[model samples]
Target: MHDPLQYEGRKVVVTGTASGMGEATAQILVDLGAQVTALDIKETSVDVETALTIDLRDPASIDASVAQIEGPVDAVFSCAGLPGPPFGELDTMLVNFVGARHFIEALIPQIVEGGSVGCISSAGALGWQEQLPILMELFARETFEDQKAWLEANQETWGWSGYLWSKYAIDAWVGWRGADLIEKGIRLNCINPGPTDTAMMPAFHELAGKEVIDSAIGPIGRYSTAIEQAWPLVMLNSTRMSYVCGEVLWTDGGFIGANSTGKQGGFGEL
Candidate 1:
């Protein structure tokens, strides 16, 4: 087993630390002895060395919050995300994809050599590859404002496509930039979790339909608990996994397996 004290005195940052898996992740990091700089739009109940209130949808808020974090950060958890439509498809994409990308990019210079980054995607993002062209177009835009303008002009095409496309962009960005990040001795990876049990899950059920959430449970017949989702994310950046890099680990409780075995519906249905 890896030493429990491995993170003693290390500094880390975790976004969306107010609740759900983000809260669990932040708590776990603190228990592992890391001094955490937590960020969220609301106050996080978890104890951290520093906590900053920042709205992920607002690029300026993210910039201001990140500026307050003094680093040589050992790790970063990009765990903030919004569930699909009814939450405004445009805003979902902004927070889930664009904002996360901006935050990760800004932290590149502060990462200590050999540090790692882990982000939360979702098993619901299974269709990411099919939407590559759309994501790449938005990805090329230089500023958050530019991306927002594109969203406004092309809102019809997005419809309820925001959450799905946002996760896709995140997965794609990590895949494309993994090598570049590694060149700086920093590894970047993400997790694609299935229906996880969190406070935010109710929003998913409301937006995607309760049947969708019910059907999404894997062979395990249940959604993963918040801490269950938190472990792999934290482990990806831990010292014990020094060799792991640029990979997207699926934490779907065999849902991906069922889909692979033809037991699940088409990716479009998800």
Candidate 2:
């Protein structure tokens, strides 16, 4: 078992702490004796030592956060993102991909040496793993406007392809960010979670239906609790995982292993 005492006296900035896995991550960190700064939207209720409300979609809000939040931070745990409304996957893509990229670019300098940064992607993100070329093209463009333009130009061709594509970008970032962050003494990584019993569960079900939700293959038999999924993140953000970088730690049980064809993974497959 990993020692929770490993994080004593570290400072962490956690996004999406308003609820769900974000809340679970923050609670665990605080309990471990880390000074955690939480971030969510304008509407959040979790009372912590420090909580920053951010309109993650708006670059200005993100900038304000970096400007105001105390630094040099030991780690950044970006957990604020959305599945958005049913049929509004574009919003999901924007919040998850574009907004998250801005967060990294703006905050990289603040990460303390031996510090780590990680985010929570979903098992669903695996669907876009093969489109490296297109995803790279999207990453090349920096501003939200560029990403929005790419989405607009391709919306007709892609439909709600944004959500999956955004996550694809996230996974790509994890794989590609070590060069930039490693030099600063900070490591970057992420986790891909399978379906969980969060408020977002209803939104995902509403968008893709129960079959999609139930299809999140896991050896655990049923969906995981938010706290169950929060452990890997807690370790990833601390110095305890000092040598680990540019990796996506899958917290999705056997979900990815069960993704035979993504549509139908026979009863058994290794």
Candidate 3:
């Protein structure tokens, strides 16, 4: 059978692989015959070529992990994140966007031409477009410290929902930086997954009542599985998706479409 995804023997890096979508993505990549390097703050059970511990909230940790990774990577699946609450808002933003961005930027030189980067954003970032002005301002700061400082200084603006704002930043960064990466023969894209059933689900439920969480579900009528979310992310970074760059694939079972059309209710309403 032809390997349409072209992952066989490919060198790929997957973050947040200790559990949830990251673990699912790593397992799937391994099964597809890719050489997977799994990374997370905790140990991952996934059978990969390498498993490294990484703290996405710290630039030093991210840099250390990158140094350990053998380069000429074919793809990167950045799935690490925090659900907020137990973790502080700033810490959440650091792991979700700031640190993640720093890690990816560090790997850019090592990524082979045509390599692709796939990130996991959130459906909660529905109105990200409206927040672009401020997001751009945050992006203007080049260094990790500078961006972190900017985020720290602008807390009041996005502190209300670090998860939402971080997801918003992810969506924006994919489009904003993707344009530049593609010129180097690399592609960057992300998936804004709706509610997914993962270890992190309970945290979200605790933060924003179960009723509200369920309301975000579209016609799908249920939360997505880790693998369900992982598939689109894997596909987004596949060689086949060569032309698809700087795109946000809403892996929400029609939630975005339905919400946009006013057919889906509850979440994303004006």
Give the alpha-carbon lDDT of every model: 0.85, 0.78, 0.93
In terms of lDDT, model 1 sits at 0.85
What lDDT score goes with residue 248 in model 2? 84
Best by lDDT: 3
- Candidate scoring better on lDDT of 1 and 3: 3
lDDT of 1 by residue, 151-261 (tens): 888777675578877888778878877878988899999999988888878888777677878777777878899999999898888866788888889898888888889
Per-residue lDDT of candidate 3, residues 194-234 (tens digit): 99999999998898888888888988778899999999999
User: Any residue pairs clashing in model 3, and if so which?
Assistant: none
- What is the C-alpha lDDT profile of model 2 across 66-146, one tens digit per residue? 798877888888887787576376777877878877887788777777888888887767755687877777778888778
Misplaced by over 4 Å in model 1 are 1-5, 266-270
